[model samples]
Target: MEFRCKKAGDECYGVKELTLLSEISQRLIQTKELKNDLSVILELLVRHLDAERSFLTIFNRQNSKIYIEAAYGYSSAQQARGKYDLGEGIIGRVIELARPIVVDKISESNLFLNRTQQELKSKDGKDLTFVCVPIIEESQVTGALGLLRLYNPYITKDENLYLLSVIGSLISRVVSSKQEQMEELEALRQKNQELQSKLDDGQRPVNIVGNSGKMRDVYSLVNMVAETNSTVLIRGESGIGKELIADAIHYSSKRARNNFVKVNCSALPDSLIESELFGHEKGAFTGADSRRKGRFELADGGTIFLDEIGDIPLSTQVKILRILQQREFERLGGTETIKVDVRIVAATNRNLEEAIEKGEFREDLFYRINVFPLYIPSLRERRDDIPLLVDHFIEKFNKRNGTSVKRITTSALNMLMIYSWPGNIRELENCIERACILTTDDVIHSYNLPPSLQTADSSNTQARGGLMYTVEQVEKQLIREALTSTKGNIAKAAELLSVTERMLGTRVKKYEIEAWRFKV
Candidate 1:
């Protein structure tokens, strides 16, 4: 280490402390015990630089506490405790603002709490300067370091601040790794909580099913978008599973525990859509007997799925745009602007661009939500998924109808494959529900096909011949093809199939396929 003195007024380098501080940094990587590692590093940096006192605080978000995990040079009484609140003093301010701050004059900085000023004075009144540095994790401020000093002629606050930043980086990696591990454990805990809840409820009410290329695209998009705050637009014809995709998006997000609200934009009358979306004060108008929170207000810190948005009235489009743009909105007949952190996931079968051109939709609103567009292909487009979807709907309806139907007849599945699903997945659902209601046997046979789906014998033969198998048979064939295409690589097969890895695994088990033999 070299030698020099820092001027009292200088806001810059303490040249004398540079070499020793650099050396302190080099030793940080070799230390293993996190607490000891940080303590040793900060202790060396402060001591070698002749600082009077130093401390490190680790943010505890769960309890809103910041424990003083490390400290040196303070009196035995002052350094005994290892904790403080988030904004209790200048130290907390560093974490709050995520910036470095220096208080050359104690009374002037205004960062001092009564206790903090008293504690600093106890350490040494000779040095009037102090510096605090923020520690960050995942681009977020997590904790801070506070350095105090006596009237040391050898060191300065600016040098200490720089050292703190460099040291904070090393400590942050350790803290962040611990934080991430804790988060993963917390996630597993939460997932277990949800599972326990699902178990308590008997069975989950919602389940997704599909194994097709189009569906695989939807699955891939869902996983990719789940990690972001992107606004998704799901476009598909009516009867398609737009709501299903919307649910998948929410359940896979960081805000999974929060509410996932769905609004049918078209189902509401232009007369009441405003009140329904943004809520209203008591007596906003007729039937507004009591004040209510709107969907946007209710879905704060969560996700809101707007369905059939293409059908919302033009006047209400303005309100939707404001909320999407500003992330804030006021209820009907209310003056207070309520801000919400809502992840907007909108779905509509109508062509929004065409609607915009016709003045039925707002161009700005469309662009705002079109950030991450997710257009769903119709059931007809993903016919390979028919059997999986059929199986899904069949199981659901069987439980609902209290029937024991376990299989879809091969010929019936083929018939389903050939029919152009004008109504999409929704139509298929209704068809399966009807089939379940009418079936007197274990198998959902071709004869159980609804009249809307049934056609003349020769055309039926041609249609069945067109697919060359029953709907059920085609479904099995598609599943087999998907598995083979991936060379029995179940995860890829699942992606090729459009179901979750779990769902694909289940099917693979049910079909007795040795999926493990395949290469990933």
Candidate 2:
């Protein structure tokens, strides 16, 4: 527990001591590589104090063990030998007691347990003086700093011990800071695993549609990550409903009651994107007449959906990256710092890795947002869910349009099933809505669908007889639509169809169509 230092009357000793302390403090503060910087600090200390060797030991409270973290003047084997339980050796005792320990001569002191098996004497054959000091933080010992030097008769026995204690205080700060970071990372890892396990016990997202194995996996991921504050990156092709997945995640989370703000990174012009995101004070820009809160601020205590995240400009990406890392930002024209407890749910259809290669995206930001990636499969990849989706959209549009369209005819449904939906679910929904409007009865027929859908390559029906029948069906449907659009005016209907009135009438008669029935 000794901590007293006798005043040295020699001016040279005082100057040397000040010089060592200044160098150690500067290096510890300036360098990001703390462990390597610490070794350098140890080397400085040993050279300044005229010591033979120096070492730092850290206590792992979880395991009740102490091991060397950094060292100077010790071989790899010697450093590897330095490990101890809480009260087993001198380093252990220094940490366990939260005190300094000094051995006048290693050979004569029974307490001097040389675990490293180094020679007891110096190169000059003088017994080495061993000194150990506890590295403490907030009144708790976390580690120890120790060094070996030949005994100096001119200096007091506890003189070097006091200097070691001061050095220990500096080491404690760096060691403790690193320990805190490690502890935080480990805690997050455990919490993530726990959340995954809880969701695996079978909670599904109620909002997202589809039961294909891929969609089910998406549902599981949404449920799993809903309870966590981790940032989520939803990757998929456009129209694959990434936004819907983002919606399910937000509404199912603890922040459901808070504002769930959404920002389309691609929709905003580059000139105004930063202002839209971080808000602006009045007079910040030419059009800024009043102060406005940004999407991040509005989503405080909730989640922000940054759709088309990859399309954000590189300049705005830096600010976004800062917000993701620090959860704080300053408004575009305001000096006041704003902090938000918002979870970010970013989505993009673009390949971010490719964007990174093209220098169009920030690599660090990519890693940050990609922590929990959820890839939504395209409609083609999960065609098994098409029937369910068709039914869902049918029921939805049915209620909206006050129509009793109960189902699609097999031929129409076959065409729908066969077409390559490059635009995914959104295209399917639009097709269903268009068909619902065209149908005059409960059943939607193939002729009522869009002409592009009836193409032989798309509908997979290319036989000569079948093609002729489909063409005729399409012609009849088109003439009926023209009549309806023209309100039974033959001339206007013919003009709309780009056909001569005589030919239109021939077709209408051939199909036995009642043109006047289309008049509302």
Candidate 3:
């Protein structure tokens, strides 16, 4: 029963040796579980080498210790007991020294710990040879492999060491790859947990569902100005949650318990805006049968949210500015001047600067209300929040409609993520609500979404010489137009786009666009 080659001067592997190695290598590559693959590999090596037993010990970088990952014949309890610190025993020393050790007699070696209680002697009472090789990856020892065999004259110690070292190298790659995959999975899990925490925090006040960087900046601004009495001007496109931000500011402020009077400047007519803001005395107007407290007076010792401030007429702006300056204003046709202590939080989707240039808005009034301007990002600017917003809206509609809708399909979510949400968060909430009403199942499929979203990209393509274009392309085109209008002036272009110069610069770089090309 000879395992060695009989040919003279033969140093290479024999036919049987080559066949066994090939089989083992293929099995290892095909195996999925690290522990199972290691166990099979150890078993194959012990049987082929005629070793009594074999085991693999893996290193834990975090704790600087080695624990048995797999053993050829040891029980689970025995394997669990095979943990060791560096240089603690024979196995540990092999890893610490980063080399191979071949002990002719285990009893004679002081380093033999026998921690797993394995039988170390042969049937004939002959001393067992202990062999250990370091598992190295990228020039560093990561683990060790141990083998025990009855001393035999048929195989040389050098031959056994060489074979074991080759196996160690193969195992090293597997261990390294497994560790890398595990680390990546752990990182992904941690990131998900962090995002979930941010979403939870966003649900606390005004239910501002977003975890994107832009939304984080908005949240920081809200926190900074919430405790102050300074007037805040919330600005963004329509449906961009400007009013929600105004509510967050008021409720989070020191006057949270006080009245939060709301006034829709656009809803009131030019003849009544002044009366709506400043209370009119009885018989002052056709509809004023009794003396009425205006939004300002009603919001005294609290806060007033002036929505769509840009819609108010210039005549009304003058009165609003007077109250902001002197904290006192006479109601329409009222002789006595009324004063109120109120914090003002105004919001508007219109571009006030453009309005002022067109003589539609008063610059003095704008300056008075723009003490602390908080710009809310539109949905397109923070697309990462779309999924969180969808989940929130779905849950909201589910509770409202008394349904059990759980989630949106993958394709449906993809469409939501890609679409340019021109109408912003409000539009998204409405879309989700509509889907909830239409969907009979728990999941909102792609077909459940509105026709506008389904054909949004195709519609853009039809407008662009029948060439398909992504949301990014539409954005780039808009940016290019703004740049051309501004003659490549980043500051002016950014102002036109309602974004900071730095943000516009980042977009230009991302799109690989040359703004200088648009210069006259």
The Cα local distance difference test for each model comes to 0.72, 0.82, 0.80
All candidates: CA RMSD (Å)? 24.2, 30.6, 18.3
In lDDT terms, which candidate is top? 2
Clashing pairs in 3: none
Better of 2 and 3 by lDDT: 2
lDDT for each residue of candidate 2 in 1-520, tens digit (9 for 90 to 100): 8443333333466767899999998987788898888899999988877789999888777446577888998899778777676886788788888878888788888887677778899988987889999988898777888889877766666777888888888778787876565556656765675665455435556655676557767887888899888899999899999988999999888999999999999999999999889999999989899999998999999999999999999999999999998999999889999998999999999999999999999999999999999999998666656767888999998889888888877668666655667788998899889988998887789988877677745544352345575566557657766896887766568879997655787798887665654544
Q: Which of candidates 1 and 3 reaches a greater lDDT?
A: 3
Error of 3 at 246 (Å): 1.0
After TM-score superposition, the amount by which residue 501's alpha carbon in candidate 3 deviates from its true location, in angstroms, is: 34
For candidate 2, which ten residues in a row score worst on lDDT? 2-11
For model 3, what is the error of residue 515's alpha carbon versus the real structure, in angstroms, after optimal superposition? 33
- Clash totals for all candidate models: 12, 0, 0
Candidate 2, residue 167: Cα displacement in angstroms equals: 95
Regions of model 3 farther than 4 Å from truth? 1-206, 457-520
Cα TM-score per model: 0.50, 0.50, 0.57
